[model samples]
Target chain A: MATHEEITGSLQAFGEGYQKNKKLKIMNKDWDRVILIKAADVDSQHTLILKNGELTVTEGTPAGDPDLVVTADSETLADLFYGDITPTEPYMNGTLVIKGSEDDIVRLDFISLMIWGE
Target chain B: MKRVVSVSLGSSGRDHKVQVELLGEQFEIERLGMDGDFDRALAKLQELDGQVDAIGLGGIDVYVYAGNKKYAFKDGLKLMETVKKTPVVDGSGLKNTLERETVNYLLRETNYLNKDTRVLMVSAVDRFGMAQAFTTAGCDVTFGDLIFAAGIPYPIKTLEELEEMAGKLLPEMTKLPFHMLYPTGKKQESRDEEKAKKYAQYYRDADVIAGDFHFIKRYLPDNLNGQIIITNTTTAADVEFLRQSGASRLVTTTPVFEGRSFGTNVMEGVLVALLGKPWEEVTPEDYMDLIERLEFKPRIIDMAS
Candidate 1:
């Protein structure tokens, strides 16, 4: 029986792995800056840089400019990552809040599918 | 004209609006404030005891005090024994109020039993809501839950999808009702087939079944094999299929529609279908009337989430 705590733990661990593999998908010359995704419950923020074939996620705010920022409630965020809720619906429903250009949002979606493999 | 009356203090779950809509019109509802006292709540209800049909002993708290040292420490089973004559039902407040409209529709409309009148519950997600609806509408209740570790997900779009998928996976007669066991691999496919096979076997043996979707037909061989699959659906196609299958009962699936979903209106119609008199008795006009009468902005409490 996986308790709620266990679910949160697994999500955190998966997020770490996701950070490492993100850059491999963003080889296009135009995509070089960082993307920020802040889930509600984790307390701290995250900075993911996808420039080269390798990806990197650090604990604090990004030193360089961030290309995009996405924020949402904990439940919605977890469901989005887990495929329970699709990305576009949440934004339309206001469950997820996005702050970035249209290009950045599309690129973020591509990165999400690449990281989560869906 | 009044049979056994069942009422609850407010509604429960996210579908309070639907439950309230269904319950408000047919039955006399006693609203209990979040800060209200239990004894006072019961006394207010007792005022309508003999005047109406029957006194439904709303929520469990009405009988047993929640933080009261005497009842909390001691067993409160005696309370039910004391109030046996009023035909008291253990109704839920949260779900009834939250999903009020749909739940009210189901309670007032759906037929739980046929000629045999054996009211067996298929899913336990909102057993309190089901109990409130059926018992109020006049039916004896038998309820159970599917034992699982991962936990059954809530408020799917339809039960037919549930039945179709579960039936396809474990089609063997031996594992007739897949919902009896823990349904694994909800959002995605299960990485391990061995685990899935083990649970399917467990479902094969279990007698009672419960879930949001339907796959019970795959488990049962014949129509008269004493199999009942109770599921909630929002799709018109599934609704038509359920009608065609001659299912024992089909409750509408009401998701907490804080925002708009395409299926909410259809789900509302399904609730009305189940809660109103008989399936054959109520018409499409009746459902539309109920929806029109019950429409209201859902109450959004900050702490509720």
Candidate 2:
């Protein structure tokens, strides 16, 4: 299991990665959504808010409902946000689960690709 | 007379019917595109259940391969299960043997391919044999499964990596809707300019681009700089499109009939009808034998040369 500090650090790294990706910003200009990341193996959740082509990550869930929910083990979730592994890897193995539209899933995957590349 | 029908979830604009004599046996082969409607395709499969000698599931693959393991697509299997009486195929049987022969043919009879050739296979899971052939022939090959299917920019360089990736991903990925993974219906007829521009470098760098025509054309760059294309299921219009894109040559693994080269599914349907056996009973050697007996040759066209 990943500790709270590790998860927080990973989310911070993901935020920095997204902020630096101009291509992802342009691509997600019209895409606005709140994504809740739930650590299935730990008592933690992170909220990713995308609005006006910008992203901000918070430690807790949004006040309202999230458009998408990503569930994975604490380590896997941390690894994904930290770019240690691609979302495709975990998603393909059934270790990571996302509840969202296909478009949203693909867009989120694109976020990882643009940030870290394949 | 044997009758074979290919029901596709592709554009109806590409539907065609042809009569051909194969090994002293006459056969009527027809293709019906459902324009990407799964229910319509399922209904068509049900309608032609026992009516046709063999049925080909086009625009979708029932199975994709990695190494020796084959993974079934849930949607493809669902579409296939709708037909109870007809022996159904997704052209994978012929794809393995015929596409391998095509690569060998190119190496033997033409100067277009050699050990030093660089190949960009747009997607390999659906055409693993062709992917393996390019690698076996000592050519530098890039498998673009991630690039084309998932909109990722990674170019897989070796078959070992491809097999490893497929083993890890295909099990779960196959459960997703078919349309999300591939182009179907009207999606096959359109191209995304933004994607084309983004992936243009892969096209420009390759000496040869090979795979399904739809995938090849989906993100095709405006200028190819004399790259050769190896694919199948192309109409005359597709040939013109390749020419306009500045492709130097075009090669279709399947033989042309009625001015178009039908997909492997249709051709496999013909073969299945000829053999008069269950689809599961057919083998690669059987396909190769029929191919030799029919003298099936790859259609090569000099688009710009």
Candidate 3:
């Protein structure tokens, strides 16, 4: 079992990596939006704001017009950034939930694509 | 670390050996392609049986799924019967599991498939898992199985439309020897570049292009800007080709390792070895579990700026 802070740190690192990735940045040019992610059981939350081809992560779920709202477990969310999980089967099987525009979902997964190269 | 080897009927040029790290473990993956020589493929399978950690038959499927029933191919079944000491599975096992996950990954998590998305599958039968996933995801699905695989040269709009043809088509086709129906192994290595160009219209019309990599590569035009390809199997060189040709994104259902995404059977053999299960004991669900645990996403090339 991972602590909420540990998962949050992983998310922060993911944002930093996504910001520094040139190939992923090229894919994310049309993907500027704010994304809210909440872990289902731990009450850990983070906001990923994407603009000007850069991604910044803020602690807690700040109230704003987010482009996407992603909800999953602390493990799943953390594992996702760690490059060991794909959200597709989880999303299809009802383990992961997303409330956002279709394009935003694509942007979020594109980050995973960059990390795992898949 | 685990060792997995495949006996492939495809050409020798495609034979490869590589190491990959997955599921918190290391794997040495080796494949021997016989260049469309069934005698050699079986002989190699015979020699390697019980020697390697796991065995796989590549470049062809063992079974076809329609509804809930599965139809097994004769050559594949015979080969499976020969391997007594080691577990062996045709590529179908991983195709049934990974291809579906890969397509759904793109459809639900990516903007590639929505109501308005136009999808063209070069040979849906070659990757039926992907074809069904796209339809289930509610995209307007097109099946080129008859056109590409059966040589009918015309695309059908729905699974229902293709199902109508499968009953008459597969029974007779499956009865014949495997290679007679379609080029397998090394036979696939060569292409009729001009003939391949005829299907350019299908490639041009779709926003999302999905299918078996061989079929996709056969018909894909040189220009594919903004097009999203969802398929299984790809080489690193293949990726460079798509990138240079202006493809926006390339999504290979199998995960990339050592500069190439592998055949479905090879991935399945890895799972069987990891789970310590006999070839027959491992169900498709088990295959799905290994993929889920590994968190292996489809290899993607997102050169779309």
Candidate 4:
């Protein structure tokens, strides 16, 4: 399990990383969506709002429906946002589960790739 | 006379039709690219059902093997399920046998490959036999399945590691849409320079680059420095691109017809047509036997002056 502050800090850092990545901004200019990240182990949830080529992270559930939902252990979620591990690693191992359309999932993966080069 | 049609999700620009005599049989071979439209591909398969002698599913793999475990792709399986009468194949049947022989042929007939060669296989799960052949030949092989397919930087160095990774990843990954796993439609026609530059070291460090042409071309660096590329489904334009990229040689496992090598799916469809049996009943030994009788030789090009 992870502390609430740690999870929120990691999510904020992930948003900051995306904000600073020019290539990711350009690539995702037209991709606007609300993504819900649920830490299964910690029973915590966070919302990632992407609109107009910008990303913002907020703790807790979103006010409306989310276009995508990513479910993973608290540690895995923290590590993913902290850039310690890639989503591919956990996703491949069945530790991370994402529910969304294929296009949105690929775009999210590409965002991670752009933010943390291969 | 028999006819075989390959309904593909690739770019329409690469569609081709040819008439060839094989093993004393006259056959009309055609490849129709659907530009990544799944509905269109399904409709095409329905239209061709019971009409063609055999159908080949292109641009998507119905199954990929790792070790002895085989995983099925959801989209590929859906495309296959549309047909009722004609046999359909996604090329996995021939990739295992034909690609292994191609490696052995190169070892026996050409100087391009040797024990000292450093090989980079872009995606091994799709062609496990070729990967095993390189390892069996005692060549240093780096399987780039994770690196190329998932944008992960990890390079699997042995068949065991690849199999282990496959066991963990492939089950869930196969359920995703085919395009998420592969490049299709017009996406095949372009390369991402940023990705190419980021992963160029893997290409520059290898003596031989092998695997799917699209995966190889997706991140192909501008300069290969005389590296040899071993793949199939190369059009004349792909050959010219390789030559300009400084590749020394090109080896296609399938024989080239009308200036391009047909995909393993097309070749496998041809084999199925000649075998005159259901695809499930046909075995690897059958494919090898026909290959030996036909004296099928790989199409090798010397790109370096």
Please name the candidate that would achieve the greatest DockQ relative to the true structure: 2
The residue-by-residue lDDT of candidate 2 on B1-305, one tens digit each, is: 88999999999999999999999999999999999999999898998998989999999999999999999999999998898999999999899999999999999999989996999999998999999889999999999997888766678899987887677567666767788878899989999687899899999999999998999988998888989999999999999999999998999999999899999999999999998888889989899899999999998999856
TM-score, per-candidate, Cα-based: 0.25, 0.81, 0.68, 0.79
Candidate 2 collision pairs: none
lDDT per prediction?
0.38, 0.89, 0.73, 0.89
Best-matching candidate per TM-score:
2
Worst 10 residues of 1 chain B by lDDT: B66-75
Candidate 2 ranges beyond 4 A from true positions: A1-35, A38-45, A48-58, A61-104, A107-118
Off by over 4 Å in 4: A1-44, A47-118
- Put down candidate 1 lDDT per residue, A7-108, tens digits, no spaces: 355346545656565333333334566767676565645676766434565655787667778777766666665545456557756777878865456445
Tens-place lDDT per residue, model 3, A1-118, is: 5568878878877877786776456545545788888888887888988776677888887676777888888888888766566665566566788897543454455455545542
Q: What TM-score does candidate 2 get on C-alpha atoms? A: 0.81
**lDDT, candidate 4, residue B279?**
96
Give lDDT tens digits, candidate 3, residues B95-203: 8778888777776676677875788887766567777888888887777775566443457887875665555355435544666455676547666465467667778
For residues B192-282, write the lDDT of model 1, one tens digit per residue: 2433343343333322222334233222222222223444322344444434544433343333232212122233333333344532354
Per-residue lDDT over A1-118 for candidate 4, one digit per residue giving the tens place of the 0 to 100 score: 7776788999988888899976457546666899999988776899999987889999899999999999998988888888787676588668999999765786676676556533
